[model samples]
Every structure is written in C-alpha cells, then in structure tokens.
Target: MKRKYIVGLHILFWTLLITNNVINSIAATRAHNTVIDSAVIFKDIMLVAGYNSIMILCFYGSYFLVSPALFLRKNYLKALLMTAVLLFLMTGWRYLLEFWFFKPVLGFDNYKGNNVSVSYYVSNIFWYYFPKYFVYGLLYFSAENWIRNRNRQEALQREKLSTELAFLRSQINPHFLFNTINDIYSLTYQKSDEAPVALLKLSKILRYMLYEGARDKVPLHHEVEYLNDLVELQRIGSKGLANISFEIEGYVGGQEVAPLLFVAFVENAFKHGVLNDPDKPVCIQLKASNQQVEFSVSNSTVVSGTQKDQTSGIGLSNIKRRLELIYPGKHELIISEQERYSVYLKIQLGS
Candidate 1:
C-alpha cells in the first residue's frame, strides 16, 4: 500500500525479467545456435530490449489508463476499443524502432534505401507481433484490475464499519436523561438518601459518554470506571429490584481500549433484558490477564409479547462490525439466544 514498497516491487519484478532476457540472449549467442558476429548479437539484444520497452508502454497504458478509467468503470466497449488503439500505436512504434535502428545495425537490407512497404508492415505487425503484445496488454490489465478490486473491497468494508461506529452513537437515546430526572424527582419528595448518589453516577456516565468515550482510546481503568458507574446507575433506577451483578478480575492497570467499544453490549442487555425476573438477572463479567481480555454479558429475555426491542438488531451488528474493523483477527465474539440471550467476547489487547 505504501508507494515506496509498490515502487520497490516494480523494480524487483522488471529486474528479474530483464535479467532472464539477458541470460537468454547469451544462450542464443552460443556457436551451436549461430555463428553470428559479437556486434550483430549485441544488435539483436538491443532489438529485443527495444521491443520489450515498447511492450512496457502497453503494460502501463492498459494497467493505468484503460483498465481503471474505462474497463473497471463499466465502460466495457470503450475499454476494448482504447486497448486496440494503444496496441496499434505501441506495436507500430516498436516496428519503427526495429526497421530504422536494429535492422540497419544488423545489416538487414530488406528495406534498403527507404523502400519500406505496406506488405512488410502488415506481415510483422498483424502476423508476427500483434498477438504477443495483445496478450501482454490483457495480462497487465487483468492483473491490475484484480489487485485493485480486492484492495477497494477491503477499504470499502472498513469505511462501512467506521460509518456504522459513528452511527452507533444515535442509539444512545435521550430517554435515559428524562427517566433519570423523574427518578430523582420521586426520590427528592421522599427525601431518599440514594438520590444524590444517583445524580453523581449520572454525571459520571454523561461525562464519559460526552468526553472520554468519544476519544480514540481510553485507559482501561477509565473504561472500567465507566462500566461501574453505568451498572450503578441501572441499579439505582431499579431500587434494589433489578438484581444486576458486575465484577472485574485480574490486572487492569496499564492497558488502553477503544472508547465505548463495550457499551453497546451492556446497553442492549439492559434495554432488552427482563429486569424484573428473580431467577435470571443481568450478569456482566470482565477479566484481563496474559495480554488478553475477556468479557461476557448475559440477561434473561422478556416474553415475546412484552419485549419492546423488535427492531433493535442494528446495535449488535454495529458492535460486530466494530470488532472486525478494530480488533480484526485478534478478537472473537460468540452469541447465544434460546431462553436467555448471552454474548461472549475475547480480545487480544494492544499495548
């Protein structure tokens, strides 16, 4: 993808190709093959190199111009026509180079005293050289398109995932603030001592969502702090009735994670989870060790009739796409849904 590397590879490929041509040139000069003079042999190799150089024009013209600008752009007819025009010019130029320089240097007198003719041009271009150059152009065009298409697909996939991540913020609806205010209002009339703690938790959650959670990376401890505050906020609203448990195990001292990466899973669990169930409560667990992190969240599902999240698939899909983009081969996600919906995620942390 880097320009230097692309150039280096081009140099390397052409170097090998020219080296092979030189070796073959030497082999063709063997006495058993022909008793040609050294100067004539040299002239022949120059002819070969001249023709090869013109073929490279075909290579570049098709790869850079015709293929991308026309072929891959879906102008199939135009691409073919342009390729034919380029081949005519390139092969004709190579013919001129041969007739004027290489043929005279080798003492070939077929066109002596400028007696060049249409029959000779047709014989060399149409019968001898056109097929070889056409195949060369096709090879370069096909190879270039193949590689470029693959790169474009991967880039588009990443772009789509990034757009999904940015869109995910919309899912964090405004209802939380409205409900929290009402909960505070009720608590204030009763003079409940938990109201102030709830407000503090609310402030922490908002501050992280607006500031730290919007950053590219946050200290792992900061994410854990946010998670703790989020769980506490949910518990406060439930008034000791939701039965949510949160725990952290192993070392989490010097790591950093993508901001808000795990928030969707927790939020989905609370939004779709059956909070009033006594036997099946929401459980969230996280562990970090040996340069790896594991997180698992499971919650009971409400009955189909009462479950409100009938069209809430985008959040889970968003997390899956984010995991693919950010962690790539370094993470795995497992989802299970029968009675209780559960998600298990394992990621190798970047230092």
Candidate 2:
C-alpha cells in the first residue's frame, strides 16, 4: 500500500476516536440537567486530549517496534516481556501527568480517592489502556500485513498469466508456419506460377505474427484480415482444388480481440479435415456485436482413425487453455465431432 493511504487511515481512525470521546463527555454532562459550564467542558476536553496522546504513543510503540521485532518473529516470551515493559512505561507516564500536571494546573483528576494505592492505580491503568490501544495497534499491523500479502499474490498471478500466454503464442506461430511452409515447398517443387504469390502472402502473415500477434489484443478487423490471408495462401497452394468459405456477418470495426485467437481452429480444420470436397468445404464464420463475438469453423472429417485422433492435438488444446485463462466464465466453447469436426467459440466483451 502507498504511504499516503496508510497515513490517511491512521488519521481517520484518530479523528473518529477523539470525536466519539468528546461527544460522550458532552452527553454525560447534559444527562445531569445542570447548567452547561464552559470551564468544565474545556477541562474535560483537555483531559481527553492528554490521555489520548499517551494512548497514541503506546499504540505506535507497539505498532512500529514491539510487534514487528518480537511478535512477528515468533519470539513469544520476548514479545510478552516487551509488551509488559511498554504498558508499565505508558501507565507511569499517564499517572505522573494526571497527578502532578493536570490535577495542579486544571484542578481535574481522572481518579479521585485518598485510599487509591500504587498497585490499584497500575492495575487500573493496565486494564483500561492495554485492552484498547495495544489491541488496536496489533489489529492495524495485521491489516497492513494482509494487504501487502494480497497485493504480492496478485502481482505474481499477473506475471504467471503473461508468461503462459507468451508460451502458448510461441507454440501457435511455429505451428502455422510449419504448415504454411509445407504448402509452399509443394508449390516450389512443382515450379508452380503461384509459388511467388504464396511467398508474398507468407511474408505478410509473418509480419502480422511478429508484430501484431505479440500483443495481448488487436483490432477485430486486423485478425479478420490475417484469417483472409491464411485462406488465400491455402487456395494458391492447393491450385484451386481447396474448397473453403470464409464470411463475416456483423460490425467488427470497433471491436478488439485477443490476437491470433481464432487461428488455431482454422489450422485444425485444414490439417485434419477434408479440403477438396465442394459439397462440404471448410466453413469459417465470424459474427460480432457491441457486446459479444462468435466464431465457428467446421469441415468434413477423414475416414481414417489416425486422422480422427489427430483432430484433438496441441493447437486445439492450446487455444482452450488460452480461453480459460483470459476469458474464464465469459467464454463458451463447443466442439462437435459426429459427421463434421466443428469448433464454435463465443466471447463476452467489455466488463
């Protein structure tokens, strides 16, 4: 916590304490139905202020010194000894001020009786002061400690989240690059005219991955453009044999989404699903609104068992983990694998 904030809390606590004491003293005087005397009220205020000053000294002595040095370090015997010493000094100081200073100067005494002994005075002071002031000091120390610990935990959680996100993003970039490179290699081996265009598209994709993809979020349309480039690159590599349909249904201009969030699903479709079937081509759709975003990808599955197992690989798992960490309960993901392998994701935007 900030120093100013801690100081403010202390000031507020003391202000409330002094106000309550003054009000209660005035209320007691009014209850007597006697004429309100300004001299008596002033004397009461002076006594309250004088005693409270001693309490403040005792409170901070424990707060900054005894509690941290002895109690916090688990030196129970030493802490008890130190506390007793503090109480003794505070009680003695108050006794002298009341007996020698206030009684003579203002003709006011907190305790009145010729029979009051030394032991009774010390015990009375201990019971009154120790229970209130010392406990308050300990409570204040405990609260500050709790706040410090909670702040530390939150900071650590943020760092862990950032590191995990970066690791997942690293996995995504290379996975897509590996698949794209394979497609380019196929075209280069055949000396296809589309190889140069594919290389240009690859450069654009790399630029996005290196720059935009590294960010926590990017404009929704920027992600859409990245997906478009991926689809076009796949089309060029397949020599018009790849049947893929990509569409957008709502306004994405004002929306911002986590970068590269939808790429895993698209890559999964192209990797494990049938790409050449015109009757059931890879279908990608994204719908957006002011409050939410919905994205879905579906493709015809292969007949082989190996391909079916490959459908649920690192890419899908990585994206699932990312969604859980980033959005948690704000996102819904559904994967259906009966006739067609499909992944649908919906994310709630804003607070």
Candidate 3:
C-alpha cells in the first residue's frame, strides 16, 4: 500500500469519529428541547476536540511505539506494564486539562461534583477511553501489516513470472537458431546460390528476434511478417523442394500478440512432418478478430524406420509452459497426433 492511501484511511477514520461525536452531542441537546446556545455548543465542541486529541496521541503511541516495541515481540508482561503507564499518564493529562485549564480558563469541567475522587476519575478514563482507543490502534496496525505483506507477495509473483518468461524466451531463440543454421549449412555444403539468399533472410529474422522478440508483445503484423521470412528462408534452403502453405484470415494489423508465440509449433511441424510431399505439405493458418486470435499448424506425419526424435519435443514443451504462464485461463491449446500432427491455439484478447 502507498503512504498516501494509508494517510487517507487515517483521515477518513478520524473524520468519522469526530462526526459521530458531534452528532451524538447534538442529539442529546435536542432531547432536552432547550434552545441551542451558540457559546455552549462551541464549548462542547472544544471539549470534544480536547478529549479526542488525547485519544489520537494514545492511538499513535500504541501503533508506532508500544505495539512494535513490546506487543509484536510477545513481551506481554512489559507490554501490559507499559500500557498501564500510558493509561495513567493520559488520564492524568486529561484530568489536568479539564480541571486546571478548561474549568478555570474556559469555564467548564467534564466532572461536575465536588465529591469527585482520584479513583473515580481513573476508573472513568480506564473504562471509557483507554480500552476503545488502544484496541483501535492495535487493529489498525494489524490491518496495515496485512496490506503490506499482500503487496509484497504480489510484487514477488510478478518478478517470478518475468524471470520464467525470460528463461523460456532464451530457449526459444536458440532452438530456432539451431534449426535455421542447419538448413543454411545444408545449402552451403551443396554449393547452392540460394545459400546467400537464405543467409540474407536469416539476418533479417535474427534482427527481429534480437529486438522485437525481446519485447513482451509486438504488433500482430510484425509477427506475421517474421513467419513469412522464416518460411521463405526454409524454402530457399530446400532449393524449391519444400511444399508449405501459409494463410492469414481477418485483419491482423490492428492487434498485438506475444512475440514468437507460434514459432515453436511451426518449427515442430517442419522438423517432424513431411515437407516434400505435395499432397501433405506443411499447413499453417492464423485467423484474428477484435476479441480473439486463432492459430493452427498441421503436417503429414513422416513414416521413418528410425526411433522418434528425442529432441523434437523441446520446443513444444517450452511453448506450453510459456502459454500457461502468460495466458493461464485466457487461452486454449489443443494438440492431435492421429493421421496428422496438428496443434491449434486460441487466445482471448479482451481485458
């Protein structure tokens, strides 16, 4: 909680207390059906103010001094001893103010009889003012502590989320880089002219990854352009043998999405799915609207005699964790591996 908000709550609490006192005084005066004298009302208000000023001091003394110094440390004996001292001091202070100052200078006294004794005055102060204000001070302290702890917890949670997201992004960048580098290496080994073109495309993609990918979100069009460049780079490396279809529906320019959110699925498709078969080419589709974004990637499953790729699931697992952290309940992800390997993702964009 901010200091200003705490101060505001203090002001509100005192305002209500003073208002209640004033209202009760007025109600008592009305019950007697007497004409309200302005001087008497002023005197009553002044007395109420004087008494409440003592209460304010007592409240803060417990809140800022006694409670932290003793009560919070579980020094109950010393806390009780200190509280007893405080109660007597405050009672004596009010007694002097009412008797020596207000009664003499302002012509009024809270205690009206000549038979008043020290014991009665002390009892009145202890039962009426001390318990009420002291309890209020302790309660306020507890509430403030609770608010501070909750805010700290929330801040720590945000920091943890940021760190985890950064780690996931680190994995994503290297994974994509490794795959793209291998494709380029294949071109270089074959002595193809398209290797230079692929290198140039790779440079642009790297720029986007280093700059835009570091951001939490980017314009949807920018992400779409990145995907286009990546697909083109892969095509160049394939020497026109790879068959891939990329499609976009609805307006993509007006929205924003998490950067590199869909790259893992695309990379997984290209890595494990048939790329040369025209009848079963890699298919990637993205549809966007004001309220949601839908993305899917599907490819024909390759039939190889070799065992499943041990490293193939890394990108998919990284993306799944990222989605859980970033979207939580706001996104849905579905993966199917029957006739074709397919991944579908839907994200709700509304706040």
Candidate 4:
C-alpha cells in the first residue's frame, strides 16, 4: 500500500513548530547576556522545558484515555466533574512551581514579590491556557468523527455494488430457465414420452439454482451436482431434438465457487447449437482442480443468422461482467471459433 502522505505531513509540521519556538526562545535569552551560546540558553530554560513537556503530554494522554469510556458508559456529568478538578489541580501546580522554584531561579520575582492581585493570576491562567487546551480537545474529537463518517460511507457503497451484481446474475439465469421451460411446455403439449423425465430434471436444476445458487458462494461439490443436473436436462431434451455431449474431468474437493458462474456457457451452447439441426453436435468439457477450473463449449453456427439472433442476448455478456467484478485479475476467458466454434473459460480461485 502507498504511504499516508497527510500523516507524515502532520508529524513534520509539529516537529518544525516545536523546533522554531525553542530556537526563538533561546535567541531571546542570548540577546541580553555575554555567555549567550546554545548551551547556556538551554540550561536557563531546562526546568521549564521539562515540566511543560511532562504536563502537556500528561493532559493529552489522560483526556484520550478517559473520553471514550466516559461517552460509551454515558457518564457525561462524571466526566465533566473530573475534567474540572484536573484543570483546577493543574492550575495550582503551575502556580506552586512558578512561585517556589522558577521565580527565584529565573528572576521572575517581579510577578511574585509584588502582591499581584488574585484577578491578575486568574486572567493569565484562563486566557493563556484555556484556549490552547480547548482547541486540542476539539481537534481530537473532530478526527474521530471524520473517521466514523468515512467508514459508514464506504459500507453503503459496498452494499450498493453487491445489489447491482446480484441483479445482473439474476437476469442471466432466469432468461435461460424461461426459454428452456417454454420448450418443455411445447413438448408436453404433444404428449411426448421424454416429457416426464425432462420435467424431473428441470425440477432438480431449479431447486439447486433457487436454493444453493442464490448464496454468495457454494461448495464445489454442490456446483458439480448442479452441472450434472443441467447436462442431464439437456441430454434427455435433445435425444431426438439434437446431438449434444457434456464432459467433466479432474478432482474437485470441497472448495467453493460463486453460484451460476459457469452455467452461462452451458445455456449458450443449447441456444446456439440445439435448435440449429439434429445432425450438428454440441460438445462441452469441464476440467477442475483445487486451484483452477477450465471449461470449454463448442457449437457450429451460421454466422449471419446467429448474429441477428444474438442481438438481445444477455448470457455471455452478463457472465463476462460478473467474472470481472468477482474475480478481477484472477480469471481468464477466451471465446472464438475455427471450423468448430467454442467458448473457453479458466478461473483461478484464491488460496
């Protein structure tokens, strides 16, 4: 993944701000003294620097540690009381340090020796420290809110994409089923003997598609079961109607595959091959392993007439789009023809 540029920039900005302020303070200290090196200036402010660093980090750390638990437990009143007490204690601590140690050592006795009114100290504390603390607190809460909103938006977008893909897959499956059922309806009307066997096979295919195939994924064993049912349906229906053969090779353990992903090519074979002529043969071969599945279907077609017939076809196009969406760069598909036309697909399931 690429680095987060904004986070790096934020760290860099804070470093520069801290360094610039420290250097400026040291320069001011050096202006009035003869022993005005970086070392002397650091020694003069060392105690102040140490105390400020510890106090500032302590305040920020404590606020973050408590705020989430306080909000989650719905203890706003307790949180507010604790915060107020902390601020009061911090104010007293700063005053004590200034009066007892810093004033004597740093020559800040003008503010301490003169009985500066209570109002003077109160104003200095409120104006100088309150805004700084409030702004830091505000930024912390704002970042949390921004992160939550971005997550929510991303979730909504994923749900939308999933819905659209499901609809597209639905369109392909239903169209194939409806056409085959209509063909069965015509055969049953003529009192054909193969009608009962065809109906039983169709019921099995429908049951699997409506139940198992509706899921996000199904076991490879279930996919093989559905394919067997589909081929049986085609075989029985095409006995005197057309010549067709379906084949499968290789072991498929308990791996999973997206439902109806391989069915489109099967449906296309019948559409383009079965109705053309009883003399013409349609052949489909499937080879599967733990890591890959290879499927190929071949059918002869009259190019001009078939092209016109395919104008409203959604089977092949829908399958291609669904593969792109689900597998992305993990799958390959090639469709072409020689003296014998064919559709070939190879998919690699992630390990």
**TM-scores for candidates 1 onward, in order:** 0.54, 0.49, 0.48, 0.47
**lDDT digits (tens) for residues 138-193 of candidate 3:** 88888876776676557546745664445344423455566668878987899978
* TM-score ranking, high to low: 1, 2, 3, 4
- Badly placed stretches (over 4 Å) of model 2 are 1-193, 302-314
State which candidate, 1 or 3, has the greater lDDT: 3
Q: Per-residue alpha-carbon lDDT of model 4 for 117-182, expressed as tens digits?
A: 656765665566656754465466557656755765565457446644554444334555666687
Return whichever of 1 and 4 wins on TM-score: 1
Quote the lDDT for 332 in model 1: 89
Best by lDDT: 2
Instruction: For model 1, name the residue pairs that clash.
Output: none
> Number of clashing pairs, model 2?
0
The best-first sequence of candidates by lDDT reads 2, 3, 1, 4
Question: Compared with the true structure, what per-residue lDDT tens digits does model 2 show for residues 90-196?
Answer: 87888788888798989976666465677886787678877888888888888877776677557546745665445344533454466678878888899988778
Q: CA lDDT of each candidate?
A: 0.71, 0.77, 0.76, 0.64
In TM-score terms, candidate 2 sits at: 0.49
Compared with the true structure, the alpha-carbon lDDT of candidate 4 equals: 0.64
